[model samples]
Target: MDKSSYAGSPADKRLRRILDSNVGLCREDAIWALDYIRKKVADGAPAMQGLPQPRLMKNYQSFAEAAMSLLLSQRSGPMEAERLRKMLREALHGLIPD
Candidate 1:
């Protein structure tokens, strides 16, 4: 996975904090960011047009998003956790263009 894109970053730290603190669900923007990356990967499009395609981009995106969702959803109880997990999975799946 592209840990480089996430590791030691303030955003990642903040995400961790949110999860550890048992905060509410993730904001829509975070979900959208993950979903957008998934779509790009599914289409085999450049993550950024001017940049070269990343090796294992799809795997990286999937892992990162799922990890983030898993952590963030921990704040909720089992029922809510399952709900959000499914939502995140569906959002990831929705990235595929019909």
Candidate 2:
């Protein structure tokens, strides 16, 4: 569906439900919540107060590259670093629309 309709659709409600859930939270959930939140705001409300601004993913590869680049720049230790990378990959690869 179109962008405008997507903002108000039942899919949006289902997304919200997923977001509201207490368990199984992940980067993908946050990404979708952020996206729909932005869309909802653009549909009427004011800009998000403290939310991270969304960057459009050019493609899956670009999204992957960006995440890897960010993680590399951060230079965390192995375990935390791996988790961060996984979260970013899932968020970008799974949630982002091509």
Candidate 3:
């Protein structure tokens, strides 16, 4: 992604820090967690009052892969990391209904 976009953004920097420092779960666990979330969304679970349901529930595998790719790419630096993160989000947002 474009590192320039996030260069001076506080929110992106905070997100990068959080992504960099957070830990506990392993890859398999992360996959399981994502699967659980997908199942919940696919089952027609309501989002929080103001939030919309995720648009990519049916494409869970792709979404999960993108997430894992972002997590596993720690050495890619903040700009690339942000790109991956944005890619994951955009992949979710870009899905069209069947």
Candidate maximizing lDDT: 1
Please list the residue runs of candidate 2 whose C-alpha ends up more than 4 Å from where it truly belongs after superposition. 1-22, 45-98
- Compose the digit string of candidate 3's lDDT tens values, residues 1-98: 23343344563443333233232223443344345445545665443222444544434554666677846765555555454444444443322111
Worst 10 residues of 1 by lDDT: 89-98
The per-prediction tally of clashing pairs is 0, 0, 0
Report the lDDT of model 3 for residue 92: 36
41-66: candidate 2 lDDT, tens digit per residue: 45643322333444333323443553
TM-score of 3: 0.33
Candidate with the larger lDDT of 1 and 3: 1
Better of 2 and 3 by lDDT: 3
Please report, in order, the local distance difference test score of every candidate based on alpha carbons. 0.47, 0.43, 0.44
True lDDT of residue 42, candidate 3: 68
Give the alpha carbon lDDT tens digit for every residue of 1-98 in model 1: 23343345564444333333243445553454465555666786542343433534544665575657656654646556445544444433323221
Please give the distance, in angstroms, between residue 64's alpha carbon in candidate 2 and its true position after superposition: 23
* The best candidate in terms of TM-score: 3
